[model samples]
Target: MEWTAAPARLATASADFEADFAACLHWSAETDAAIEQRVADILADVQARGDAAVLEYTERFDGLPADSVAALELSQAELKAAFDALPPAQRDALQAAAHRVRKYHEAQKKASGESWSYRDEDGTLLGQKVTPLDRVGIYVPGGKAAYPSSVLMNAIPAHVAGVQDIVMVVPTPRGEKNPLVLAAAYVAGVSRAFTLGGAQAVAALAYGTATVPKVDKITGPGNAYVASAKKRVFGTVGIDMIAGPSEILVLADGTTPPDWVAMDLFSQAEHDELAQSILLCPDAAYIDAVQREIDRLLPTMPRAEIIAKSLSGRGALILTRDMEEACAISNRIAPEHLEVSSRDPHRWEPLLRHAGAIFLGAYTSESLGDYCAGPNHVLPTSGTARFSSPLGVYDFQKRSSLIEVSEQGAQTLGAIASVLAHGEGLQAHARAAEMRLKG
Candidate 1:
């Protein structure tokens, strides 16, 4: 296939621009019937048979046999051994990334995770009490790829929030383990870990098996089956999100190098065939330059096939009337990662309000945010950025309202409650409040 072949082209000046843009943004997170049914059966089977079912699914799906699910669990000593055995360079990189992630989350905890209470004029104390979850499960995609970064992202935040038991789960297909993942677990302070994946792993986490203890919440991204499983087990246990495919949109003002922008698009495109990558610029000439750069540099990428399929399938090179129009369209798209590759990024940043993470200026690439940018890489994907936020310490904490009514205050509140309860014709409720009153 010719590398210079263009991606879908769109002009904001067109009469049917809205419809076209909507088409590009459309992606249904709903899993297909077969995957949903399979996930349902797996979740139910694991719930019923516990460790035996997990073992069965792990063997059948991952082609790994374990006498017991407990045998699949990696001990802390093994995790630390993996960390110790990594080459010096890899060890330093992992430690550096973890340190930065931990520092960022510690700051996040100070900003939003503290408990506070205040006494009112009536001498009644009221405020929110912040508490960390007892336990959490971090799912890292394993087998073909090892994302040590994901281990740091999910586990470190919960650790910062003071979660005592952080259980890590990864699919080690055919008993092939990634040392980096285990190393991350050791560094991030995971209390337990198991070699498991898919709906069965999620089910094991949601409903405690004999081997895997149930967690207060589950947080991480996964394949379609994992996504479906997360959604199914939501009410039974809290979940982070049913995340859609990855996406990135760049708003260029013809200042940054076309090669840089082209590579940025390739970054998200290489994630999967359905991942979306688009560039919106007023300069048609610059857009053409980026297209050429895409053609030239794409052949060099190891995942060229995935990048090509992603670009041709869902990517676009859009022309807008001006930067203002570009920002307007970007808000509508509410992309996962929005890069303002311009001279004065801040000037456009105020106008660009909706994105999971904004990469500013000519130098900032979305890849930095994914690794060690001090901010969370676990962002809201698809248009969920319009309403949601990046995963943080807050996601691992819960709040409770504290109320200590003084004697005088109770008298005042009791009369109000009695009146309302009597008005609602609930005599028992009125009497209960009246009992608190003296004389």
Candidate 2:
């Protein structure tokens, strides 16, 4: 069968541009009611029954029958063996990626993850105390594909942030464990590893089982069931943002090769049918070249069918009035990955804001960032990039405000606190402040 992938074409000056553009960007984040109900039932059952529920769900969903949860656990020695058994090239690549990730996060920790303090003239010391969570659970998607990159991205940062315990959960269908994932866990310092998935794994992480210890936060991507489970278990344990489909919006000035941009779009489109890939350029000729390349190259791709469906369904190749207009539209979209494919990327970069990650040059493909670019690939998807951030060292750490009020400082602060407390009609709060005040 012949396959074709044609994105919706639009011009900024068209009369129906606004309506069409909004329609193109529309994606409901809502999960099916049945999935939500199922996830709720699973969460409740796991929370109530603990290890037995997890074991049952693991067997039922994954077809990996386990007599006990302990039988499902992957020991440190097993993880190390997985790493050692890898081919020389695979081992080198995994170690290299882990090194870069660790270095980047260590630098991140130094920049914003560190504690700081300041002393006022009145001798009041105000500061912040930075500390890592006791433990964290990272859920790596193992159903459709195994992502060793995710293992590195999620666990390395927690390790760098001084998190004492990092629990990793990956779904291994029929007890088929991905060696690379296990190797990554070994390299990234996961304290515990489990072959568990779906809402049951999330419940075990969030609520804590007799075997799987509860985590302070759960971070990583998953299917609909996992996303819904994370949303439901938010207050019980902190969670990273609920991500949506992958997205890539390229802002081009017709300088970069059209084939490069086409392949970049394909990189995201191949993820799933719902993933979005878009191109915004002022040059009409360049837009045509990209579409031509996309059609010419689609047949050569192994995942061509998936790419075709994704591009046909959600992709767009928009022709803007100018690069500035493209930048404006990109900001509105707040894409998960924004590629500034231009000669002077920096010029347009300052104009662009609200992207999960920006690929700043022609040589910098979004895929590089996904693998070994020394940055987090676990980014905010859909349009959530407008307010959310990529997972980082800061995500693994918490802060406590430190205020040391001197006798002189207490008097001034006490007076202000007493007035505010009294104004709010809380006599007990007012009295508490008054007690600290100097007569």
lDDT of each: 0.93, 0.95
Q: What's model 1's lDDT at 28?
A: 77
Per-model TM-score on C-alpha atoms: 0.97, 0.99
lDDT of 2 by residue, 187-210 (tens): 999999999999999999999999
Q: lDDT per residue, candidate 1, 1-439, as tens digits?
A: 5343357899988998888887877777768999999999999999999999999999999999989999999999999999999999999988999999999999999999999999978899999999999999989998768899999999999999999999989999999999999999999899999999988999999999999999999999899999999999999889988788899999999999999999999999989889999999999999999998998998888888889988888999999999999999999889999999999999999998899999999899999989888789988988889899999999999999999999889899999999999999999999999999999
The clash count of every prediction, one per candidate, is 0, 0
Which regions of candidate 2 fall more than 4 Å away from where they truly are?
Answer: none
Candidate 2: pairs in clash: none
Worst 10 residues of 2 by lDDT: 430-439
Q: How far in Å is the alpha carbon of 371 misplaced in model 1? A: 0.5
Question: What TM-score quantifies how close candidate 1 is to the native fold?
Answer: 0.97
